[model samples]
Target: MSDARPAREPGRRRLVLWRHGQTSWNVERRFQGKTDIPLDETGVAQAERAARLLAGLRPTALLASPLRRAADTAQALADITGLPVRYDRDLIERDGGAWEGLTSREIRERYPAEHAAWQPPGGETSAQVAKRVGSALERALDELAPTGQLVVASHGAALRLGMSHILGLPEETWERLGGLSNCCWSVITEMRDGGWRLAEHNAGTLPEPVLSDDRPDAGT
Candidate 1:
């Protein structure tokens, strides 16, 4: 297997959407939406390891959610790369409202209809999150240099929704993008046509080139 990172085309920028390390709530499978939870011991270790690898990418800028779990995770990379972490409120996780502290099973039992729709009563809707988080990402990109790399440390749901928004994927098709595991990341690269392409998702290691039918040499 090649250990190379994804190939970057000229005039293209890159964004690494990284999820925060795990917390106690993550282990318990509790809804931690917008909660200010800190990283657990294991989470701290995970962040440190991931940071070492990310630092090697030499990111140009680091941005993160204001929540402690995400801030701390970003700090790990900051410590290694000497990059200042800029916190953005819009990058915060989805607000779970009445389902904030409930386990998945509990939410299913208590609010079956809402759970089926994956909406939390009184919480921000998926559209709200996608727009908010997506706008934040765009603002950050505006500040980046052409061909620069940005690493955004955020929550799982927030990153996924924001990515879908950036790629112009409709809400109904957002589910086609899978969730990122704790401390994993997804990479998006700018296209020559001014759009974005997902290079990698839910990945721990650096990305390698993808082989697909779309490639010119596919049948070779």
Candidate 2:
């Protein structure tokens, strides 16, 4: 989305966080998680290319979601960046609750009550998936020095939520940012003055791309 921040012509800590590639769940439109699912063959190719592209940037450190798909995606880049990948649960996908593995239509038909209960403004009451995202993001900013380049391997929802935090977006604006695709990234740079700016968002590098035809461009 169009981050209204004036591009900090040159910024400190060029933090680049990206989501993992597609999975079988993605193909069938299901919620994935601690399932230990590997990337699909296409996802492999996408991660490979994305890794190659990011390799030269030489990130100072790499943090990733412990999930297999995300870890796999991080490996592609780590293979190049030579950065160690540390695990973090904060990067986990928002649990879909009773609808964990079901599609949107399936959720409506099967677990409508649970579906209705889980709104965007606030994730599962005590579950607090957003809190995890926020904590991890805050940790990244707090723990990781704004020195060299940085990269985080995470999921679509968390990445979007983190980006929302980066842009200082209202909770209602979540719907506007939309969903992210496999191996696509929203590159952002942390400005020196404690602010952030967007580089490019949802930039696809998938070799056998699972492209989203419906995702809109970043904007206000």
Candidate 3:
């Protein structure tokens, strides 16, 4: 979900991962996954802006999560990049298990400590979610024969955990990067050392966090 399909040429690969535009569920601040909601008007505008922003990237393959929000964003990016859309389930948001359609406030108010939905059990914690996401992205890379430019449309919650995972941030950092805006992007680069590194991390997302590299804690 985080990585793109391979490009036609090899040597160095560049993958641009963009979180998808907003949905009605997103706008209303609800949990989404298998929710199958469409983007709102503002979300459409956001996709258009994202399309223009990525228009000149010349990506060879436009990949997206199977979810409608992500698929829709990928379509717009495809139109701009002149590439067809490819769907990957790994790109999908965490199952969210029993909390697919509830808000955090609702969950806390309703289920409280008894909430199994608070943290996924045998499902995906932030680390597990990112592992699968990174793995799914790697699979996408392998599928594109001979390599090609790639773009992926993802979601904010997953992206938050993913960014944390890629940057080696702590689990407590989850809330810090959780509330990303629609169609925003946070880039990461594959370092020469083979460890993927954060590049312009959270460049086009929300809620500013003044960083302190000295204390790489959950400050985001």
Candidate 4:
């Protein structure tokens, strides 16, 4: 008799939206925008730790922004999972143009109007970011198996905007979605109706914690 288990229907695929680790500019509350800032010591450590957890999830594909911060973050996962990271410019942070590197207070003081509107002088609109990121994510999803998962390492704004688009949220309501903390991630899963759903947002853990101290040994 054949010992093979019966074939099962394809399961929902997952897309993990991850924000890159913190940078010096982030600590200073500066607008990193499209600037390529390398991660600080703490940022590196964060990436490594998050990678260890995410690797256990068996992500089948890794994708990242070409910017140094995001690339480095994704590299950590690549190191653990032995998966190659595909860089996409569409995953880069929103273009801040003249606002890049400017601290939040400085931007407000120098250009109150633009600050209120949250638009940089020559920067990209949120709509533009959402479109590009959404397109890239769609392409990545096509490459993933129905039961497989993909991890996308990118900027806070970029990932949030992309996720909003994927969920078909209205442009005016995109602001309702909060940004992800450094190294934190969101999970999106395909629903049975073929629509995407936000299963988890800003989840910082892989093996979710339980309430009691009766937890078994990790290796168990």
Error of 1 at 29 (Å): 0.7
Q: What RMSD value applies to candidate 1?
A: 10.0
lDDT of 3 by residue, 1-220 (tens): 7665443334344566787776766645466754566777877778888788777666777778888888898888777767789887877777666666766457557766634434632345656777777776777666644435567788765665655665667766555653445676765655555455656544453523321100113333
Q: Pick the candidate with the highest lDDT.
A: 1
lDDT by residue (2-57, candidate 4, tens digit) is 96534334569999998888788877778888888999997899899999989988
lDDT, candidate 2, 74-106, per-residue tens: 999988867788888778776544555556567
Which tens-of-lDDT digit does each residue in 1-220 have in candidate 1? 9964343334678999988887888777788888798999978988998999888888999999999999999999999999999999999999989988887779889998988778889888889999999989988887788879999999878888899999999888887776777788899999887689999888896422221101112111
lDDT of 2 at 97: 49
Stretches > 4 Å off in candidate 1: 1-10, 205-220
Candidate 2, run of 10 with poorest lDDT: 211-220
Alpha-carbon RMSD, each predicted model: 10.0, 6.5, 6.4, 10.5
RMSD of 4: 10.5
lDDT of 3 at 158: 63
- Please estimate how well model 3 matches the true structure, expressed as its whole-model Cα lDDT: 0.63
Best to worst by TM-score, what's the order?
Answer: 1, 4, 2, 3
Question: Which wins on TM-score, candidate 3 or candidate 4?
Answer: 4
The lDDT for every candidate, in the order shown, is 0.83, 0.68, 0.63, 0.82
**Which candidate do you rate higher for TM-score, 2 or 4?**
4
